[model samples]
Target: MSLLADNGKTSNCRPAFVCLLLFSLLQLPRPQYNLPFSVLALFLCGVVSLSLGQNDKAQRDRLIACLASLILVTALLQAMLGFVQALGLAPQTYGWVLFTPGASDVMGNFGQRNQLAQFLGWGAVSAAYLYATGRMGRAATGSAVLVLALMMSWTGARLPLAYGLGLALLAWFWHRRVPQDETVARMARVLAWSVLALALIQIFNQQIDSVLQAIGLPIHVQSGSDRLLDAGFGARRRIEWSKAWEVFLQHPWFGVGLGGYAWHSAWLEAYGGWPKVPESWLFTHSHNLIFQLLAETGLVGTLLVVGGLLCCLLPYFRRGEQTVDNLLLISIAMMLLGHSMFEYPLWYLPFLLMLVIICTLSPAKGWTVQLSGRFRQVLGVSAGVLALAYAATGILPYRQLIQNFTPRNENTLQASLDNAKRSLKLSELSRNPLWSWEADLGMVNYLQPDGIMRDLQLELAERVARYQPFPTVLIKLSILRALNGQAEPAKQALTMAIANYPDYTPVFQHELARYREPELKPLQEMASKAVKAGAAQGGATEAGRLAAVMTVAAPATRQPIF
Candidate 1:
């Protein structure tokens, strides 16, 4: 239990060093969207590690308890928020919670159901930790479990349920095999409670909904759980995973070069003749974490990251005993990692932070650095200051950019244009470079002029498409190209757009129909052909064939402009 013992060491260099190397990977990309998060993680690890190294066993336990409590409280608050949202007691807004509109989604502040479910699972685990360790009372633990179950059910995500059941079964088997490990028994019980809670919710979810409706409360329409057994439930993820695999194959070495999944997905669909995703759905990630890392960072990045984790965990492995603390922490870490296998949970900063903290806290004993008490104090203060500075310089500017670009009633056309320009300027100093492309795209939309300005808009659209490759941008770029009398390239862009969204031909035709320009006729003809092909073939096959033919006929240069 004594993290530092009488060794009087004030630092653990191995973890801090490994953590620094691991987080530094976040800065490998030009955009560095996760740079601010990386810095914050470093600061947190340094402070926590230093604090533990200076404490005795009792003090260390208290500090760890406090940290665990903080995580549990945050997760509990999110669960409560989700519960309220499920009951229609709060306004779901962009500034606060953004539940998917008209769906039975309850994401709290995480903005996605699966992510929220994983976070709530962390809460449930934390509650079990507190209860098994005699920190939380039985009643409080039960209430937390019940609330988490209801919220998890409302999210309508089934993967977490499966994860819970799987973990529970593993815990039971471990306990049975060991027979002497109290930690395994306690963990098994905790997982059993979670599994039971979720299973009960699934069984009675309809009754709960009916009761709420009968009580005159307006509940949002629920997505049926029957979809969990549907054959096509994960079809989208399969499509995205296939696209990500193709991207990895093409890049191989450094992969697509960080945060480039969307860009490459667009490029592949446009040029590689891949199957088109459903309209209105954009795959920002490959859904699976391993595939995403392979597509975005490739072999080198994945090895560095995976190797760093192994290095950090080596001490625990070498210890060879499953202590209660180790089991608890490993269970929590495994929940996140297991979820990563199915979905990109760690992409969000909070989940990433949790993983970092768990890693930092896991190693019981390691190479220690002895420092004077005064020196340790100075180090802690320096880390705090550095963390504050990084947040101010990086996160603040990013926040401002979001606010500026986010539409409000006062944001007129000119105001919106000015905000986009300002956002572009801010991106230079901000840690996030992705927003720069977004700002440029906004300018392309807000700028309304003729002649050279129109040409500038086309150029901007082309530039954004290289990085973002969003369907709308491709369509707009095609229209602009046609207006500029570049009919062939225009058709190529339209073909790529249609290829990415083959089933959306009617919508594409409608957009083209809105334009009175004679130059748009060919683009309309292409969309109409795709629609006819889709109708004749009855799905993706015929439409995909047409898109392939069109792509070959007007093949745009394969070289990426970015």
Candidate 2:
């Protein structure tokens, strides 16, 4: 119900009031009080974890061990999937999985190589923890760790290997400090196995492709493996980090707003002269949690979060002895924490939930909150029910939208249009209504007459731009303006796209080249001039380098602008 108050304005409630104050201090626009789905997940998971934390140590350990076993098993399965993909044997479109799983893209159902690698790293940690606690045999733990380590290497993400090395050293220290503890000794052995796997993979990566070729596998592992050879961090990450820093400087005290980085980054590229990322690349997060928080929440939110983390750690730091159990738990949680420094694994619900649970299990040095059993039950049930209810609210609209937008026979056009209307109406109940624009666009294009279609599309495009401001939105707006006999506005919009996405000049040319419509001739001419101007600047190759990181295949619109 609190989320219902987010109508693009600050609410009088405590959380909303705090958000309003933060936005005011940051000099950003009036804050929206909408609660994103992640917030609810975080709340519910925290409730569950805190409740678990209050349990007896034996009960808690049993639960933790079970959770760790689940993590290890999940990771092992994903690792096997990744290995299949790398071997060029994965079937396309298996069940819910999409994407061409070839050697260059070993996603393991996560849809991203980096994310797959990080999750596998977490699994490796779990396997170690399980072995150290005598829950798993040494042989099984060793096999799981080896497979996970090998798959992580094949994913071509260097950060996990680097993180593994650092943690391996820490494990060694723990083993040395507590030489008598078999748990520490076993964990150190697992860490050593991971390090050895990393080293073995590095040495044999170049030859593995040749051997695969000998076996007639169509794909070679060379593409992703080559990334491992380079020591420098990616250029795209550097540019993103740099832009995030500039945003921090602009609003250092507060921030643009929570979840504002992507839109603000788009706005900056279009009008604020910020260095543009690759075409179609929207930086949802800065790729670094610290930088993202600094850019989104600024110093105030950063301090609050960091200070809270420190307070949690202060208990461990002040302890007279750092027990191996505590260190092991911290190490397991550190898998996600270290990954957050390089990637946004926590953005995914499973990883975030796991992190919350692990942190809850970790012993914090502080006064304990001794809630009565009845109180704990009430709190957990209330939070879980609220989260479940909020989640269910989106299901109907999402289903309707999916059904409404599915490709249908021309005979069912009227039915599709009717369903689109119903879907849009249902979507109003959603806190995030941006998705309704798709149905609106579909209805406008199909139901509206030719005489008004262009005008309605223009209006819709403009409205979307107000919220999104992506380059494609600007280009679509330009195309619509040209189609509507407003050439100047069209050119202005095209100019904005050119300025923000010069690397996309090739894409613009490709799209505009199909402009057989007489009214769109000016748009084609403008694109040509922009291309030539970009080439004349002697930066074509330089611009192309960034585009190599990520480029859109084409515009996202269903109907071609031409």
Candidate 3:
């Protein structure tokens, strides 16, 4: 279907939009605390309105420009911050911004350096498109590319740096394609500036890095080898993706329900004979977008998501003159695709929203038909009322969960649980791995250890495992399993726990040491070796590449990190 706006009546627009909304809505926004569902809803509404031809061509172009500018500005500011950090001028972030910083990295406005890199990549490309088209000035646009590229380099964000350079080189070819009536000299000038900017960006890491070292200037917080990077058996993301694949295999048809990525990882760590994470950087979604889609939504859901994206994108590939907007969309699409391959860019509301806007912005045939007259009045009123109700009721639990952290008073504690339960309902019967898991942890904390109900403990244990493979919770589960007389399962659980953690708690060590189960001794040894094997596989001299090595240790621990 033609995607550009026109005077027209369209039926397909409704279905494609509905599918887009479905794919987005099922994602469950609470997992990313910074990207709440309300934000997604609002952005969805705007995209739908535009798609339904509520806005004209002029308005559409303006919106696109505005969005590009917004992305560029945010990236520019982030790069500026990174430069300052590189110069050892920025302050360290200890507390939470979104995902609490575990180490000193140039995280920019984002809590993670990787996320900021994703945004910087988009910004660099956007600037390139604007400069090549002469829609924006060479100096300003060139500086943006230079600064963002430099930041991406310094932060060790390899993909963004690579993407920026690749696209900058591609932009050179576009310079000859510009209309002669327009400033051709302008294209050449911008091309030269961009090349210079990219070159500087490429060397910023090595040159400035050496300088910082030689001067011995105290840098802003140094995140010496990160916990998420250091704590996992292999590369953290590979292990997380492997767990996601395992989840898909178990429930290949319908999958393990929506918003279930973290839970599956928890289960993998628990029953799969891998130990739980001690750190907070939980893999809430599969780092690989396709794998996450398959694990969370199953086959049908994955199909729907893929189909919906095609519906939006296929229209753009048709022959058309290379316009500024087209270039911008192409650049944005590549960057988004790059991040989604190895990062959860779709979970970031702003990125998703930007994508929806970009993918939907194209010319269409026929007369634009907007809802109007008395029918429009009724429709508008109904939409407002439903929006208000949803905002008030559906989001109430998310708000409560964010506000109420930990509570000791019985009423307050119950209220928090109630809120989380309510959130689960609004979350399409799913739980936010981070916040929802916190509520569950709080519940376990409040229960009396001696009098805790076995069934309730088991239920909580299973649910917690689904969300996060927290060692404390898993230990508690194993203890409960033992108390309930599930001797074999309990032994297996303890073995896996020991396998995961090289340095476990004293309580866990004592319990394992004291266990008399002769059957479990071999299993414990297998689990231990599995952990060591994963470490050895990741121990190769190569820097940062996830090794394709898989050990022949016990199946429980030998699964390749995806």
**Winning model by lDDT:** 1
Instruction: List, residue by residue over 1-562, the lDDT tens digit for candidate 1.
Output: 4443334334555553555555454543443332344345555664655555445446656766776687689888998778767866556454466555555468888888888887777777777777768788878888888888777777877777676766575566456666786655775677688778878877788888888889987665343263478655666577677778878888776776556688677555566644433444456787888788788777776776777667655544443445545555666677788888778877776677666656666564456566555666666677778767766776765666565553333548986676656645544533345345556654444433235567877877777776666666777888889888999989878876776666566777787887777888989888877766666655556445555335323343332211
Candidate with best TM-score: 1
What is the C-alpha lDDT profile of model 2 across 1-562, one tens digit per residue?
1122112222112222223223334433434233243344545555655455554467666776777787788888888777677765666536544347333467888988878887787787778888888888988888888888778877877677676677777787676677888877887788778777766875687686677678887545543346756644455566566667778999998776666777556544444543444454455676777788788878987776555555444453333334545555566566777778777887788876766555555555323433455655566677877777767875875676656553343658797776556545533533355345455434333322134557766776776555455556767777777778888877767766665576776676776676666777887876777666556655466555334322322222221111
Model 1 residue 481 lDDT score:
90
**Candidate 2 backbone clash number:** 1
Instruction: Select the stronger candidate by lDDT from 1 and 2.
Output: 1
Candidate 1's C-alpha lDDT? 0.66
CA RMSD of each candidate after superposition: 5.9, 8.4, 7.8
Predicted structure 3, TM vs. truth: 0.69
Candidate 3: regions farther than 4 A off: 1-16, 21-53, 84-103, 129-136, 165-196, 211-246, 266-281, 363-438, 445-448, 492-507, 510-562
Per-model TM-score versus the true fold: 0.78, 0.76, 0.69
